[model samples]
Target: MSVAMKGLRNHITPVSKIIITSRSKNIATFGTTEALQLDFLPKEAFWYFFKTIAFGSSNPEEEPKLAAVCMEIAVLMNGSFIGAHVIGGILRSNLSGQFWYTFLEYYRYFTGWYIHLQGEHQSDMFKKRSGLTYIWSYKNWSAVTATFHLYQISSANLNDLPVIRTSELLTRDIKLEGKFDALEWRSSVPPYYSYMVHHEYGTGNNHDVITAIESISFTIDRYYRQHQGVEENLRKLHRMLLRIQAIVEEAHGRQITNQAMLLQLRMVRAVMYRGYYFLDNFRYRTVQAHAQDEVGDRSLGLSPFSQFKRFCFSTRTRKIASEVLDQKELQKMLGHLENIVSDMQEFVAFVSCYPRMSRQPYCSYLLLENCMFGRQIEQEKIINFLLEPNHPSAKGINVLPIIGPGRVGKSTLVEHVCHDERVRKYFSMIVLCSADSIGGGFLTDTGLIKHRNPTSTGQSLVIIELADDDMDDRTWTRILHNLRGEHITPVSKIILTSRSDKIRAFGTTEALHLDFLPKEAFWYFFKTIAFGSRNPEEEPKLASICMEIATLVKGSFMATHVIGGILRSNLSAQFWCRFLKCFRHYTDMHISVLGEHPSDAYTKTSGLTYIWTSRNMSVVAATYSLHQASSAQLADLSPILSNDVLTGDVEPPEKFDALEWRSSIPPYYNYISHYEILAQPPDMLPKRKRSRSLSEGLV
Candidate 1:
């Protein structure tokens, strides 16, 4: 292959480009021109591809139910084209909702599809100044080994650099390993809760394990965090936790701790379990909290026997009555949480504040082709300002400020200008600085302006992103001074981006205020993200929905990305309408995509955002209530409250708050209300009342 490529390169005259695709790294390296490795489709792109394949030639809008089923299956396909093709063919053969549901059940156990976690490659580590090298391979899947040396890191940091290795899956009866072992901590090992309790119950019998799983699944539906860690005092908490788990496991054994403290700890443990499971599996049920009173109600039948069993070996009633513990428990629970949170915050602060040597700042310079939708004109304008000669009378370095609100494409436009062929030729060196990198001794600390070559001179273009308004004038003045000092070229220039108008004073040239995308351009960009390559003419109904969605989203690139992501997996009219109904609620509400909320089901680890209602009140109560009831009981109660509960007509009592929100709702009503919130669109409620309904809580 190398010889052939060399021969072809020698024979071909005026060859401008050469493309090569190979499973072997050595063969790919034979290309005389630049060799690039292909990357797996991103989540959004993967979903779009699956959606198209699953519903080819037919509008998913027609089969909302089937589309919904397909959506669930698509998420599991993980970026496997082969799986999509096979699954798509299966779905295409049948359109029945029953068939789809059966397919879902079958696919739940299907293990044909798999996601390749990070892969490792063996290669010699090259020394610094060798620059970057890429080597591709096709073991397991196509992967590229990136080799480079950053002078900023010591030998210790290199050793600490996380090495990717294939990890074993946690399954039935796996022995506990590390304290942070992903599954062990989550308590999702062999002889799962279901297996343990299932044997004791007859047909249609409800088990404590079932309730626990249901509760976990319910919690996941609302505030399902994929992973959460309980803050341990590292000072002998491990032995205590292990002991607690052991006692909890034995149906007849009990560990006597302060009843209130035990409940508090259990609550913490349950949250931790849910968080971990939230991260591991998309559809996993964890049993966090269980009712002591409800234990083995049917298994040993009769209340007296249950009481006898409890009296013989009970964790509660050792220190205090559980009912007494419940009374005024809200305040005590809050106090415990506050203390825990305070300690966690302090630990976070200490970790963050730990001293470390500064390293050279790095940024990706691979200019994305056609990424800047409406930034062409802005790029050209910035180029004119950047390359434009400084005034003859002007002294020191000149600064050009590009200002805009967050996510208004300021960085993108400047990036385009920075990477422009003209600008590349014009500037000898280009330094990109983010807001976080700025502080006292900014350039020196970041290694942006190397002191080793202090005497060297070249026309440099320094790009500064002013992230915060807190940057004082002294820092800005010092930053400008260093750019054009004796160490830098006399003609060096600076360009800055900021959301603050106060930064304009620092700009030697007039500030360039970035304008929001024009309606045509904005919609064009929105369509590109939301629709990808799907043709509007072929899917006019979806196209129209897309147009409406554009208006509902905030006019920002980030907003477009988020809404487009939500739409990518969903193509049916019902899904679109559902999204539209809640569109205002989502946009208006403070949706934290960061997924750091400890109490939210949609956790940072899970990367899945559960659809939440805008109605005021925490969803915790509703989540817990649904968890307490069995599926049959929940099913039976859904019909009675289906109409009023969801309509916002069933109002909470006057003087409702967090405590009342928890204590007031019966489990049946709570689940029904939650389901209503999840299923019903906000469009059903009156505008004035809907606006008024929003309270300061999770729902």
Candidate 2:
């Protein structure tokens, strides 16, 4: 075919265009010009097309339920025009919603089974232009009488073979005792082709249990020797993690605009974090055990009794180590990491296509600690919204409401977006106003007006930071009115960020909601900060302890830095264990009394919370009524720090100021807390909660 096309192309007139399209890459190479590869249709376009054909003359709006089911079927089609026609024709023949739902259920089952067996969605295979043939063998099901196979074949004589439609296999029960061909699809356009699959039914024997056991025994003997295989697998996983990290770092430095690409990047990041979590947990535990052995050996010298005690301890340690470092588990981890690496082959290739952004020359850890973490998608959305031109038919200024829980980085995201080079270049003047400032008439202030860019007529970007959720509709309207009156340009945009969801209603566009980082992402961020410039593998014991501390910290950005700094300062395992004990006690006590985690209480509500404070070599629980939580410029922060108070280095007065954390990134403000220590009656003292020690299970 390629040779024929090549010869035919040369015979064509100079002005004539010869367009060739094929599913095969080899056939595409025969073209003289660069091949234009087609991707799946955009979701919106596909939905519209699917709706038109599926409903035919019927009104989709009249049957909302059927339309919903049709949408699901359309998604399953994966933008295949052939699939849409076949499935839509089936539904169009019977306009019952129940029938459509039944078809959808069967379709879902077929696709799900394919995904389960092949490790990818059937739709994905369609998108890849892979042949429609898929083989499934029911080896374990006793209900099946014989094995069945599916194949895609092309034949001119359709009447000679027993034909069955793929839909019949899904929608109806058909008994087959012999081989037959299933018609999967038939192209209706030019060069009409038929997609047929051959199904063969036969019996298959199950594996012998004795032989399987022997094989398993051999594998155990080979890989479980002195845990050498486990170590090798760990090394492989570590190398893979490093590769993923390199790609992720490069991606972070680039401006990735494609939504699909961003989603893939996010998946890659998740896999990378999971790999690191497991790797770090295993390596650190091993290192800590070895360190403990060294300490034990030094303490218990060569005396007969000491040697006997050492032997017992070593035996117990080895047992624990064996349980933790199971070779099979290590193999599983390695396999997963390898699979992720394989899947990312294309993602890594395309990551390089994105344009790189100008970044500071700081170390990755430093950058992670100082910059916002795990909100790339949200950041992109904000930037896109800000840079987009106002719709010609739109009225008033554009408002984007960013709503999130307290300390969830809503303000930081806006600050970063405002600082973006594109945003700075697009807006002539950037005005920042707080809820208080708005209420205080800062918009009409003569001093603020005087500082505006008078000569430049470019649009102004107004950023309003609302601290509470109680902003009324009237107030919001007044703010917009005031902006219009002052700026005199409706094109000027406004970004409203608040800790409450109430402000979301005031936005002209969809509100961007911010949430705390997932456990995996937060662990990655915490680990980076906790280890600073040091390699975690070098201080495995500390790394192990840091994971536990991060788990207890409950995704608090302030606690991450504070606790991370404390642990980094003192690398001793003993100190880390002590800190972990204190933290655990703190959280457990709060959970017991308040019925929730202390961090949750701190961030989610403005209520009187019991804070952890130790004194006189014991854990002394102190109650503090949170008066106000506010952000201030670094210079304005109180001298007293929360770390000092928590560590019992300085006992604050009844009512005092304590600095929580100072932001190292844009809009760098010191988060301060004004609280009054509550006096607890002796009779009201909470009972002590007992918990496991770090060394209880392991020697």
Candidate 3:
């Protein structure tokens, strides 16, 4: 089909339309620009179909009770018209309410049972038992072989999609494997579209870290609600939380693809989310106990209005305090979490830099391309500034700081401007070096370069490049003073590219903040890269998917380029759909790659917050480490591990132990505290005569 589409694209008329339909969305993209989607019938349409068949075209008003039941059954079917048709036939055979009600319950039980069975890996033979055996107890259903017909209908409606129970459907058809008949049978299960890209590879154990934090927060919240003052244990817990937060903040930027790191993260998240799950019950109980106490106080010598005043005032003025459940269950979980965190911190402190790959050196010269988006305006502004030397400076040297978020094409914009014919004619030498390459010896090197070039006194261009958003004002100022002294020429120029605004304070005469691609430009550039010359109108489905991808990235050119590269590898719509499902994880992975670039060296510096920014994403996270560890860089964490940073604190890591806490909670616990808020009447209470303090108004 793809080959056919390729041929058609070459030979077909310019305005001709071609349509192809396939079960696989990937197959639908063959030689197609647009894909038209057909949705399932809406409830109203399904209801009309049900009424005509179930009632033999009779008016539903005559049998309103049956009509109502059918309506409910339709809703339960989840827009499956085929289910309604088969079940409607059964109703036609027996018009009694009991029969219909029994079948409805039977259907629910069958589905739930099937789902439950699929969750386990049972033998194939055990699954093929006749559907009639379950329904044989019911009176008329057995006589008509109703269960057999129901099974047929159910199997026909079921598709291979894992949306509901693919395992059950697959198991039932195990005998027919490899046959053409089996292939047809397999199509019965519908395609599941809501699958998310597995994050195990990308995030590693970050989910565990986050879940643990949530559990701690839940416990802390509960503790404060119960107690009015800070306890020693509570303060200790808070300090531990702050430390964990610091580690997570630092680690969030680093790749967590290591197995050991992932294990630590998983254990921590499990212990925390699990601990919170059990401890949460105590929080509700504590709130309830307090509510009961408040209720008992209402019986004191106070008016109804006064009571209302007290309740409102106390609720408003309530402060969170340090009070935790003394239950061994909670203590056990908290202890486990503390140990996990301790180990995690130790791991973080000891982790070393990823071994650098020996790649070919990058070319000093810029290769400007016409396809580059959002560079024209920036290039022009930078070139105009460089060509005209009217700005005020100490020693005929001007520093223009180009500041913006990461991956905003600051380097590319400046590169294109440097490569311009006019820029080359105006400036003597264009030297681009990473900020890390600059040190105490930079002045001597620049002095040597200046002395060697004694023939020309024209302006020299020095490009100071920084990748990380961490160029400090003091560093920049020192560099500028040293830079001015090294040059023999009266007028020298410096173009500083950094993501931090700290450069602005030192010696920046002018700043150009590169903005992201505007909405129209972003879409145009994205579509061009994703589809190339293919008209999006011809393949609407692919176009739709591209739009979704655009939304996820929020107009990042680098992201757009990365997504385009991934898409170019495979043209299948299914591949594209799957990519879309896991697009966020992929996006993060790419941002991490960008952060590792030599130009963004700000990540290794101390006290600097590293932000992974796209046109739309704001991932500005503050990086921190163990307080004892002098260096904050993840690359230089070896010192921390050898120094016992984890044990240097108050206590040991593994004081608490519990096997039961490791076990997952019961599924039914999902619905324990599901509550609904009811609207109160305006006249429920009289207005208060005076505003009252929380303690003064209490009964």
Candidate 4:
């Protein structure tokens, strides 16, 4: 082979090429050029090929039932071109649904028996050149009498042997007393190969075959029940959701003075988000399946057998597959949604009673992205505190403290409340004073009066944002003294925001502590914003990937939007998987080194964070000295965006400014961070220890 290839190469011109193909990798070394390894057709292409050949001159759409059966049969073929041709011919010979079902039952049994006997799928067994063994029972016989060994054969005089068709084995007349060669299938394409199996008589009962058939029937029935009327249920769910959304939108347009009604509205909105998530997830199941299959196919040059081993043995893959295949859970979710909608009839009627508040028209998702999320109750509390009237005997101003960790929407919450039409109408002026502004003499009696609205009540609402919790009552007293010199009334109020619990001492009212969103709520929020207008159901695999990403995000809104935007920009499963991998690596790296996740450090305002850049897939350690800064300071910083750095769009300097994210909504603060790229030490821990550390950190 080497000598022949060398002679052929010599005869070929510079522009001309000699192409060679082989099933074995050893043949590649015989060529002078690099070898090109071909992979199995992607699931979509293979399905199209299989169905086209299986149902020649017939429309699959017209025979939906048979087409469905053909899909299962195709899956059983396991990307084998010869298998497709052989099975396709058998199905094409008999167009009857009963005939197809019978063939499927037999095929399913054969594959299952082979797996049981070989400890691997028949596909993998064949790929390894290992003969497949399975018990065969005839329908007319009360017992199993045949044992088969299926294997591929390549010989010069293949036609000289007695050829027995695989379909003939399904009949009662076929009998084998001893081991004999029986042709299983013959390829009609290039490199036409033949598959033959050896058969021998055996003594066994038919119980095992009957049991396998029973199990298969049960699974098929369950699947049927799960998918039956799924389309109609989804349509009904969509319609009910629209109705519920109409009510929710109407409620949002109104100023509901009733606290109970407001709480009910929140419940309705939560259910709405979940229903939509599941609805899209179910509708796009097929798309997600194809995307996931593609991800598996592009496993960095792994062969079909390697991919099969990974699929069967990878714990994570198996778990995800099990979750994705749980049709019962999906059906249950549908019923739950239907029940919630049915229960909302009265709630929907009462939502219209609240007086309307004038607002700009916007889509729900757009409004969510540009406005506050998962903070409706907190926003209402702040607004109520500002709008409440003070007692006649009350001394000094009424103060309410809002405290939370960094980037917990402390400033954004206050901004949204101050912009409320009701609050604006109630207070004569709303002044926002940061800790720096107060210390720098930005707030004064003259400034207060100057900033106050002319056409309004004499009461002023002052919102003070403290940088930390160390501020004492004296500072609050001084601020009040400066405000009291102006046109402050008994109804005047002070709202203090800080990240420390010590600041709560300055407030006369109970401090409202903000926390990260619960897992379910965050998933809903992340899914909504990350998926944007694209229906998540259409890319279930991507949605699932997003779900994992959301968990890693640790409920940080900044991470959600930043990472979500990256994912949303590229809908490709491969890109999303790459991002997921890099994110997980960095997250695990941070935990292994620092005993905490980067998000945990981010919430605490400063720490070491490991970020992965796609540039050569290197890990960079960025020690954050500052978590945020004013939009004014953004002018002095580098033009590099944090996302651009993470995505490897641009290289980062040793020490430079990177804009984390800028809020589009209230406060409109530009979050900037200062980072120095510290050298990452070589991994010294054993592989087992590193994995253990990652698992512990995740927990």
- Candidate structures ordered by lDDT, highest first: 4, 2, 3, 1
- After superposition, the stretches of candidate 2 with alpha carbons farther than 4 Å from their true spots are 1-223, 285-333, 361-367, 435-457, 486-491, 613-638, 682-699
Q: Rank all candidate structures by their TM-score, best first, as comma-separated numbers.
A: 4, 2, 1, 3
Candidate 1 lDDT over 1-699, as tens digits, reads 657656666543755666766655776556666677776688788877877777878766444445657777776665664456556665676676655665553343222110001111111111122333222111111112232332233334434543221112111122222211111011124422110000011233222222322433543333213112111221123333343333322211122222343344345444333322222111111110021123321111111322223211132211112222222432343344445544444333332343332211221112111245444435555766767777654475777888876546576677656655556667666767765564445344543531122233446677777646446788876665555555433436778887778888877778888866655445555766676556443554455556656766545554465456556655655555445544433433323222122123211112222223322332211121122234565455443332222223355332111110111111111222222222333332223233324323113
Q: How much lDDT does candidate 4 score? A: 0.66
Query: In lDDT terms, which candidate is top?
Result: 4
Put down candidate 3 lDDT per residue, 667-699, tens digits, no spaces: 101101111111221232121111111112221
Taken over the whole model, the C-alpha lDDT of each candidate is: 0.42, 0.64, 0.43, 0.66
Per-residue lDDT of candidate 2, residues 578-638 (tens digit): 6665665556555654567777755753555655553322333344433333353435645
Candidate scoring better on TM-score of 2 and 3: 2
Candidate 3: list runs displaced more than 4 Å.
Answer: 1-370, 392-394, 434-457, 486-491, 584-699
Number of clashing pairs, model 1? Answer: 12
Q: Which pairs clash in model 2?
A: 147-202, 151-197
Candidate 1: 10-residue stretch with minimal lDDT: 113-122
For residue 164, give model 2's deviation from the true position in Å: 64
List model 4 lDDT by residue over 1-699, tens digit each.
Answer: 757656666543543556877788997876778898999898889999999989999877545457767988898888887667767877887898766766665565456444433455555534544343543533332124355566766766566887677555544456544566776677776667788867665433233444444444555455456545655676877888787778777777677767788788878888877776666555543443345557863211112333223222233222233333445666687678778878887887787676777664442446367767778767777777777777454474788989898878888888777778788777777777655454423334323331345467767777777766567668766666665553434337888888888888777788999988877678778987888888765667788677768889998888887788887788878888767756765665556556677777657667666656643456655677655566667776655787888788988888887777888787787877777876653354223234333333321
